[model samples]
Each structure stands twice: as structure tokens, then as C-alpha cells.
Target chain A: MKAVPAASTVEVDGEYRLKREGTSLQWNIADESALEAALRLKDGDGIVTVLTMGPAKLEAALKELLARGADRAVLITDRRMAGADTRATAAALKAAAEKTGPFDLILCGRRAIDGETGQVPGELAAALDILCVSNVERLEKTETGMRLFRRTENGVQELEAAGPLVVSMCEYAYHLRLPGILSMRRAKSKTVEILTADDLELKTGECGLKGSLTKVITMEAKYPGLRKGPKETDLSKATEQIQAMLREVRP
Target chain B: MKEILVLCPHGVDGGLLSKAYALSEGNLRVLVLEGEEQTAEGYGAKYIHTIKTTPPDEAAFAGWLAEKIQSWGSTIVLAPATIAMRNIMPMLAWKLNAGLTADCTALDMAGEDLLQTRPAFGNSLMASIRSLSTIQMATVRPGTFRPVEQKANEPEIIPESGPAETGKVRELSFTEFAGGKPLSQADVIIAGGMGVGSKEGFEKLAKLASHLGAGLAASRSAVDAGYAPFRCQVGVTGVTVCPRLYIAVGISGAVQHLAGMSGSEKVIAINSDPKAPIFGYADYGYVGDWETIIDRLLHLEEETL
Candidate 1:
């Protein structure tokens, strides 16, 4: 394997703190699908980096990435970035990515579990002016470029594109690899670089509360019906009921 | 008292409109936009604002909606989380600079804010989000909210005139899938996945669907396997459904598949593998060969009925 300096970050409290100081291979929470695909490609000795912006409590997510196979981690911690909408969060990530430098691939999950808008990848791609492929299922490193299998409304589509690309990986792309004992041991000693507003040369208006284009006006909890424990039935009876119900509905 | 404005799309299903009305509480004024005559009549909202359409475009629609939002001084806006609605609502939200929660499975009036609950992280977790802005917006998933019964005999309708604009994405042509029924609207669904084995196996599932007077649906894997059409696939990439009864046969319930039909009133799964993920969420599960079980059920149906 070519030695590409990798960099990844963790968002602690809300700052993009970099791990591995100056290394190239970085892994962060790529919660967008298209971004993940772009990052999985095997490019020449060029470093791969990942970064995330979230609360200090999310260190576990960052650590998990390291255990899986990331080179380093950076944690971005600050209170100002809390409860940020997509635009604000994307801005923070964009700022961090710009500072990380000369990256060839950026990967993210197609949509974060918390916010399923599926907009950040496209929005970030727009910000970076890079090509983005969303909902990618499989990614392979090609000799000339990267080949990707993306899921669509119709079926899986295969595409070959050249780097500096940003692709998002679908949830089903691969079972997140578990960190082996050796990798976990190494990650335990690995130092993470923490970044804040000062480290990243971001405009005050573009960083946190001020940069967000939208705001949440109101919030109310929804009460989906009460959860009942699993209902148990014998196979024969269950099968009979299913048959009867189908017959009644059909007849 | 704070005034909240709920924006119901012009031609949404009457069933969906009823649910939207039920969700409304004190001081929440529901405004149904008049898009098509059929939709307007079915919705029967107290306030119906009509916009003339001559070749619709995003700019014209945005202009029309912006004028109304300003005039009404609406606080909150609600729309169905469908592809069509999602395409337009984001632009509208951007124009208004309002925070919008998309694909909200649950909505409730929590003090001053609307507590929106939606699935996050591959449907493994649920997050409750609140907007901290003047105009809170949300797009609710269809079939999650229960439509209320119509109380009034005739609902008041208001019509307004405005200039129509051209649409950004022009519909050059439209083609409807030739199938049993659209899975999203189906009351009963018979869906299959990779476990169905072959094309001949899929035919059996189709027969079961037809016999049940239900729509035939498939998982993404089934579609990938070429056993079903893309439109009939049910998942994140396909259609989300809240059918009355969903029967999954020869399919292991992946989170993607569950995301589409988890809201069904009843779910039954037939798989030989007892540990299949589908059994976890199923109301009833049979740990046996699908072919044997389905053949038995079909025979039972014939003998009994």
C-alpha cells in the first residue's frame, strides 16, 4: 500500500480537532453516501482524510472510525455549532476540508441518521465544485480512475469517474468493519488533533450561528402509538389466519 | 394566542388531508392550496387559495407561495413528504429562510414548537427535532398520521387569482407502470426479496398477491435480481408505504425494507430462517420453507373458501 498521509477528526463539544497532527490518511464520520464513495478510492500516495462536527459526546463515533481503519482523527469541539442546520454544518465541514488541504477523495454517508434530508453531500459538492455520486453501494479502485456501483430508483448503476471526487456511501454498501484488537490498541495511543474557529480561517459570518441560512422556529414531540411487546402465535394458527384474511380480502 | 399556518398541498389524497386536519390544534389555521379541481374539491379546506397554471415553473410557483406566506403571516407550514412536495418545499423554505424538517414520522404541538420525530441512522434510531425560528416547517410522511373523520357538511373554499409561471423540470412525457396497483396506496401488499430464488418463484409470489387482491411489491434485492420492476420496489430508493396489511414472503427484512413498511397495521413474514431480521418486526412469522407454506396456504384457501 502506498503511504498516503491520512487525516480524520472528531467533533467534540463542536470543534473539528484533528488527530495525527500532520498525517494524510484521515477518517471522520462520512455520514453522506456520495462522500464515502469518493473517499474509498485508491489514489496515488495522496492522503485520505475524514472529519466530523458534533458534540463532545460523539467521540465514540470518531473512535469507531479509527478502529475500523482510519489513519488519524480530529475532533471539532465548540458550543457555537450546536443545533446547526445543514447549511451551517456544511459550512463548518467545508472550512475544515479546505484547511486539511490537497485532498483527492472525500466520503460521507448519503444522509446522517439524525437528519435524513440527503442534502449535505450535494450541498458540500456544490460548495467544493466537485463531482458527487450519491447512494453508492460498492466502490473499487481502478487503474485510471474509480469505479462505483450506485443504487437508483431503477437498480444499481455502475459508473467510472476520475478523482478528486466526493461520493456518499449507502447504508447497505458494506457492514461497517469491526476494529481488530491490534487496530484498537493502536487507536488507544493515537493522539487526536482538536480544531476550533481560530485554527480554521473561516469568516465569523460563515462559521456557526451567524452563517446558518435557516433557523428552527418551533418544536413539539410526536407520540407515535404506544409500543407493544412482540406478539407470539403458533405457526399453524398464524398461517391459517393469514390465509383466511387473504381470502376474505380477495373474495 | 399564536397563529400557525398549515399548508396542505392542492391535490393530496382526501385521506391525507383528514389526517392533517386532525393534527391541528388551537389557533392552527389550515390553508389548502388549490392546485387541481379534483384535489381542491376532495380536500374541502376552509381556506382554498387557487393559482392559475399556464406552464408551471419554480419561479412562478415560488412567487405565488411567497405572496401568500407574506399575506397570511403564517407561522408554521406543513406538507406531505413526497418526492413532488420535497422538490418544491425546500425551495420555498429557502426563499422564506425557514428551517424545515423532512420525512417527519410524528408531529405534535409541544408548547410553542412542533416536536418532529423522524428516523435517523438507517432507521436504527429516532430523533426529535425542534425549529428555533419564526416560521417552523415540516414535511410529514404519508400514512403515519391518522386522518380524522369529516365533521362539517361543507367546508368553506376561497379562490384567489394570480399569474401562472413555467416549471423548471418539464414533464416531456409520462408513463404509468402496468402492474397490480401502486404499492404506496395498496391496502394489502405481497412482497418478495432475494430469498424467492428464481423468476418462477417470483411468479408464485405474484400469484399470491393476486389471490389476496393485493399489490405485488419487492425489496431492492428483488428488483436487483430482476424479479420485479424498479417502481414496485419498496425501500428508501423505492416507495414508502403504510399499507393496512403487509405480507413479506421469502424476504429477510433489511432496515431499508423495514423503513418502507414498518408502519403497516399488521406484518406477516414467511421465511425458513428463524433468525432472519424480518421476524423481529413481524406480527406473525413462520419459520418454514416459503414454497411449502405458500402452497399450503393457497390450498387451504381453496378448500375453506
Candidate 2:
């Protein structure tokens, strides 16, 4: 999850730079919602550990999660793991999770704003050999097991599953809560366990671009289309502009 | 001729069928799940292997397809990008020790090699992927390619009838929301974003949408804020629409949100932030508060009506 100053964000170029040099990371809104979903389900039980795979710079991001009620944080950062596609990325994360587990449920954002693949959770679930439920809007504790309300293209689907499952939360469920002074204090003193590929027993060939199935060969700017005149701020003029256009296009 | 296996769960997947036809040099065996053989053939499926089962579970369905592909000697595997299939394709690929590229928007052949290109990084980049394994697998992006009718070409239909092997996952209860026009087919849509302010703000959007005979949608921000429902959220995580007219209200147009609905013929964006990225993509932009602009638009629409 990589969030940055909205105004400074630029399009990814051949250099594959996500953000400008001076830009810093913040909370990815969707993943924040996911953390909230996980915290609600954990509910005063179980250690809700936040796991992420990125550079050492993302250590601050993991610490930010701690302030949001994540009990512990683990960051897997290795030069060998750079440019790993979804499958290989999951392979490394799977190694990290195994170290953090025997867990009940593994939760993630429905889709990362950057990748937008919405594939890692399923691939990771397959790696962990567990049931993967995605787009979960709401989850409540039931006597037998947990009940999940999954948001789909049509509507919502209700599902019941036992523990040791992987789930991705729908952004519509709940936004992440703000960190109070006490939580912020806790986060300051906490240390994020930074692990390398060697620690995870991941080989260089199996963790990065060398192991990934996909490769980004080209990145071109999208073609610009019909541009109406400069933005009109005057209410009366804007309304007239819209009305005139509507009239011209009226069937 | 090469034997290619295409997983067609829906009525017919035009993209996969067309790609399979070209790849196989006219040899295609469509492994369908509760599909019509006649319809599959119309998409140029020379052979349709229907997997008959009760609401086929993905795990079981993938297992069955893997077996069929192995025995049938089809080296190329194609699946349409669906939620279930997205999960299944990776598992199948892993099981077979193969390479898979999901949501491929383009496919081509280079000598004996198959090339697949899919969008990556919020539609900012295109990934050209190929598999080194014996079996090449790809999940085709839905609705990217047009369906060509091959009425005269009849398929050899092999219906594998009976209940499929049970898997760990079971069918769950599905509930459709209070009906609204499906975004996929909506001709006109009025969508709001984080800047829309609140749930009440969305009510304003809905009113304008109703007046214009358009569907109502929202960005992930509005949906997360409880201003709109998840089903109404238009983005990577929700619906991909190409509505004729897409009116974006208070949207900053994050690349994540724009990727879904950028295909609109006409886009009108209303936002107070004059420097907003959305202005770059919209055909028309009104730099003002959405409430103010929407109010005027609503009044104008009412007067016209």
C-alpha cells in the first residue's frame, strides 16, 4: 500500500517511478479500510499483525499501521525482491506469513491503488493452501464460524466459513479510524521486524523480475480526446453551457 | 492444427474464442461450464466440451478442466476474467507449473510463441507476458473483443453430463440489491466521488441522474464514505462501464477510478479543484463546487423536463 501527496502524484513512466523523488508515503485509503475490517473481526482477540513487502522506506508505512491498532508489523524488504510480479510477490509474502502464522484469517485490501490487479490475495491463498474470500463488505462472529457479506458485481453474497481463511475487504465497509495520542505513542516505541530474502529462504531467481511471469514492456500516455473549452466556474454560465450542449445533442 | 482449451463459463467468450482460433490455426476445443454448444460454435468453437454439474464450484471446475486439458492434449488454456476464474486460473497454473497472465487485453502469435499483453499498475502500463512452461495460460479481459458469428461452422459437442466432484467450498446465498440499471449497459451515468461530501450529496446526484434518465454511480471514495453502495462504485474493484455519457461529480479522477469508465463518449466533470487530474481527461469540466453546479444542472433539467 503506497499513498502519496495527491497533488504531486505523476503518471508512471518507463522509469517505473510511482511517485516523485520528494514525495512520501501515506495511508492507501482502501487498505486502511481493510485494516479496519481486520481489527473489527479480531475484536480484542488475536494479534493483528500488519505485513507488507516493499523497500525499507515502507517501514514508516508499517509503523503507521501500528498506530491504527495493528498489534505488530513485519516488513520484507530485499533488493532481490524488486519488480516481482503478482505470483512471485505472493511467494515472498507467503514466506513472511508462514513465519507470522498460525493465523485465523489473512486480510487485504480489495485492490491496491497502484497494482489494481486484485489477484495477489487469491494467489497467496493458493500458496497458503486455504480458502480465499474477496470483496467482503462485512463480517460478524457467529456461534459456528464467521459470517461474511461479500460485495459482488450484482449485489452482496453471504458466506459462512471456518477460520484459517484469506479475505480481502471491500472499501465500502468502513474507513480506518484515526490514531489517538495513546496509539501514536505506542507506535513510536514499536519496532518493525525487517526481514530480507535470505531470512525468508527466498532465492534471488525466485523472488523478483527473474521469477515473475509478467513483464511491463511499454508505458505510453493515453491518447487525449475531445477537450471542451476552459473550465467554467460561473454558475449561470456553466449551467447555460451545459444546457446549450444538451440542446444541441437532444435526440 | 494445435489443440487449444478455452474455459467458457458464460454463454460464450468472444475474446478467448477469437484468440484460440488464431492460435490453434482453426483447432479449438471449448471446455464449457453449463454453456450452449450451439452458441459456442457460433463463436468459432470447433469442439465444445460441456462440464455438466450443479453450480460448478471453482476448485472442482478447475480440477475437471485441468484433467480434460491434460488428457485432451490441449496445450493452450484460456479463461475469461471473472472473480471465480481469477482465483481458479492462478491455482490451475500453479498446479500445472505454467505461466499465466490475467486480464489480457491483447494476444498475438510470434512463430511458435504466444504473446499476451495486459494492463498493469492502474492501467498506466502494459505488461507483455509469455510462459516458459509447456502449457500457456491466460485470462482474457471480458468484452475487449467483438464476437464474430460462425453460423456455418458446427462444433463437435461432447457433453460431460453428471455432478462434478465435490470441493471444500460450497454454494452460498446470493442477493441482488434493489434493482438499478446495470452500469455495464447504462447509456448515461452520473457518478460522484469523495468530494461529493456526504450521503445526502449522493441523493442530489441520484435526483439529477433520474431527471436525465441516467444511472447513478460513485467513486470508491463515496462508496467507502457510505454515500453510495458498493455495487454502485465504479472502479477497478467494481464495475467497468463505457456509458455514452459519464458525468463525474466532484471526482478528482484517480487513475484507479478512471480506468473503469474512461471509454465514455462524452465526459463532464464538476469539481471545485481547478487543478484536479480529472479535468485532464474530461471532455467538459466545470471548475466550481459540485453542489452549486449540480443544483443549477438539476434546476435546468427540471425546467427542460
Candidate 3:
């Protein structure tokens, strides 16, 4: 699970990247749902490990996941991994998966709230050379594999995958449970495992800005209103105005 | 010469094809997997390529396209950002060691580079990006571009065949979303948010929507609150809509919600909060009780008819 900038706390600098220095972070909403699904599916002996790639500041957020019933937490953080685009981020994540996983399934939020690219899960699947399913609204563990219901624009597609798979979970499919006082206390002692570029055996050239394939040319703040000033009115007048607008559109 | 490769994996939306064709500068090679060649030609495709075998899933299709892209030697690729292509394009880009911009709102050529523009930071910021790799790729939403006028043209048809990755994920069933007209296509949308209060409140909104021949849409909070269905959701996490008129009731106009409906031609906001962000986006604002407003609107519609 990734800790992204809270929507309300997002601040973009004059430079290309977001200004993360003092911005607050929260578990991505879709990722929380992904984590909830994992927690629910885990059997008695099954372990729910949460992995995230970000700066060291993300450790606190990972511990929060540990408090909320995750068995383990791993943070893949390296100075060299800074400014990694989706592809390079996938490369680093692929290495971490190899280091810590031989698991049956991988779950990711459909997209990061900040980038809103919705591309990492597919790129990660490619990097790991595995099958990927996205926009999955529901999942059930089967004897051989897993059955998933994916929400598309027009319909719901029910699919079954037999091998290792990457699933990009739909937002709020499952609400994440909050940690109890006892669990929160116990979670403080559990250390979050850290992995660096050297630990993943990733080359310097294949990490961070150097490894990224895309560059942000510019960023412009999108102002909210097209209308310079709205024609504010009472209920009666608003109703008339709406009627006029409706006629203009419908007629 | 390097050509603009538009991947119409499924049926082509003419708008997407025409827009790509215009950007292609008469050098567009359309790769249609399960789509029609005639549709591509109708939208001004000159060099049409059709896949012989349909790949089972996005993973298999991406594998096939990656190999074909190398052989075709096209540097720039565009596809409609449907669910399947959203999955396929990234994997294809990864395989080609390329950069891919997702859900691009705008596309242009910066010299030889494909300048891709999209909403970033949950629609608060618009980012313009470019790929540095050998191949440049981007996926555009289906209706963001308008279809060019259809014209009669003779097009070269090329048949291509490849091995597909098979027997991985099996499709069991598909259920088409049923009910009123889809939110994206609706000319007028009556969207409710958290203040709708309950499922019953949404039903009231639905009644008003049906009365007006409009579609019912909901904010993410409304969907989360179970006041509305996921299909009716409009936001960053939901469907982006560009209706001719959008009537927002009780929506606070979170940036996420605003992103989806920012394309609306005109907006009318009905919220109790006088200072709601939604009022800033609205062409007309009414700070009052939504229930009273909805009831009045329903009565007004009946009388107007």
C-alpha cells in the first residue's frame, strides 16, 4: 500500500514535482480497500504483507497498516529511487517483489491519487511478467485460483485467473477497518523492513529520475469556475433560471 | 517515416480515430484488433492494419502488440483509454521500455515528441508530459475529441498474425449496466452528493431526473454513503462526464468531483452551504434546502410541460 499526499494537503512546487516536504500523507483510498481485501482473504496461517515504495517518511504510514491487522510491512526507499516514473517505480517494485515474495497474488490501488496515471499495476505486471486484472470490484479465492468481478464503464466482467496475478482494486470496494487500542500498542514495536536500491540489486542508472522514461514539461493549476461570477438567486428565481437553461439545452 | 499508431483493440469510436487522424498529419496507421476496418477507413485511416487472431486478454494482447510495434517501427502510439486498453497500453509501453501518459485530455507533437496533457493531483493541476524513450505512447478517453466529418477514401489494408498468450484468465460472464441512459452520454445530469442524506433521497433525485428526462449521477461520497450506485458515480475515481447541463444538488464540489464534471457546458448548484466550492463552479447558485429545491423543480417541470 502506498502513502500518497492527501488530496487536501497536496502542494505542487514551481519545480516539476510535488512539494512533499511538509505535506501530509494518507493511505491511498483505493489501496486501503486493497489491503482490506487481503486482510479478509488471509487464512489462519496466511500472512498479509504490505509493501510501499516511497521516502522514509512513509514508514509511519506503513506502521499504521501493521496496526490495522497487516502481518508485515516493507518499505522500499532509496535516494536513488526518487523521481521514478511509473515504469521505473515498477522496476524497483518488481525487484522488491522478487526479494520478499513468491506469493500467489499482488494487490494495488487502481491508481495513485497524486499522479492519477492508473498505469503502475499494468507496468508492474509487465515487469514481473505476470497476468494483471484492473478495476476489480469483487474477489473470491477459489480452489485453484481466484475469481474476480471487474467494474468497467458499461458492465461488470467476471473473470477467473489460475496463476500469480496482479490486481488493481477499485476504490472503496471494501472499507478498511481501524485498529483497536491493543493492536495499535503492539504495532509500535514491530519494525518496518527497509529495502534500498543496493538491497534490490538495482543499478544506479536504473533507478530514480535517471531510470524514468517520462518528463513533466509543465503543470498548470486548473481554476474551478468557467463563469466569472455565478448568478446567485433564491429558490423561486433559481427554479426559473434552471427552467430556462433546460429549454436552451433540450430544445 | 515514423507514423502515428492508433490501437483500436476493441471497436473504434470514430471520434477517437478522427482526432488521432488529424494529429497524424496524413501518416496514421490504425491497428484494429477486434474492431472494423470500414470504421477506421470512414474516420480517415489511410494505412489500416487488422490482427488475424484476437488475443485472449490484455496481457496477451500487449505481448502481441509489443512485437508488432517493433516490426512496424512506429514511435508514437495512441489508444482509447477504455478499461482494456488502459491495461494493455501500459504493459506494451513497459515491454518497449517506453513512457506512456494515461487518460490524456490533450495530445500534440512537440517537434518529434508526443506532448500528452492530463489531470494530475486529483484534477487540481493539469500536467503536460513527454516521453523520452524510443517509443512514445498515450491513451485518450473515448469522447474527449470530436469525430471529423466522414469522407470516402481508398485505404490500404494489411493483415497481421501473431501468437497469443493463452489460458491464463478466463471470462465467466458479463452483465451490461442497465437502467437509465449512461451518465457520460446524458445531455442533462441531476447529480447529488453527501447531502442527499439517504438512498431515499437519491430516489427523490432520480424521480426528478426521470421527470426532466435527465440522467441521475452521484458524487463519490454519495456512492460511498450508499445513496447511489457505483454506476451513477462521477468523479476522479468514477466516470468523467461532459453533459450539456449539470445540476449539482448538495455536492460540496471536491476537486475530485469537479474534475469529472469540469467539461459540463453549464452548471447549477443547489447546496445549503453558501460558501461551497461548487457555487464557484456553478453558472447559477442557490444556497438552501435541496429537498425543497428538488420538490420545487419537480413541480416546475410538471407545470412547464
Native contact recovery (fnat) for each candidate is 0.10, 0.36, 0.71
Q: Write the per-residue lDDT of candidate 2 for residues A1-251, one digit (tens) a residue.
A: 43433422645544444444665556555667778887777866668888888778888778878898888999888998888877887788899999877787788876665556667777777788776777778887777666888765556778776656777776546778778688889889899998899999888889888878766655544423335537777777877777675555444
User: How large is the interface RMSD of each prediction?
Assistant: 7.7, 4.3, 2.7
Across B167-208, the per-residue lDDT of candidate 1 in tens digits comes to: 222323333444546666578898888888888888887776
lDDT by residue for model 1 over A1-251, one digit each (tens)? Answer: 00112212211121212222334332223342333343344345444454767556546656765665566666666776665676666667777788876676677775553346755654565456555666666778766556766654334556666646666766545544567787688778776666776677666666566666554443332222222324333567667778766655453
User: Any residue pairs clashing in model 2, and if so which?
Assistant: none
Q: After superposition, which runs of candidate 2 have C-alpha atoms over 4 Å from their true positions?
A: A1-8, A11-20, A43-45, A180-189, A223-251, B1-3, B22-25, B53-57, B161-167, B185-215, B219-227, B235-239, B244-257, B265-305
Q: If chain B of candidate 3 is superposed on the true chain B, what is its TM-score?
A: 0.85
Distance (Å) between predicted and true CA of B105, model 1?
1.4
- Pick by TM-score: 1 or 3, better one: 3
lDDT of 1 at B252: 89
lDDT of each: 0.61, 0.73, 0.84
lDDT of 3 at A31: 92
The top-ranked prediction according to TM-score is 3
lDDT score of residue A128 within candidate 3: 91
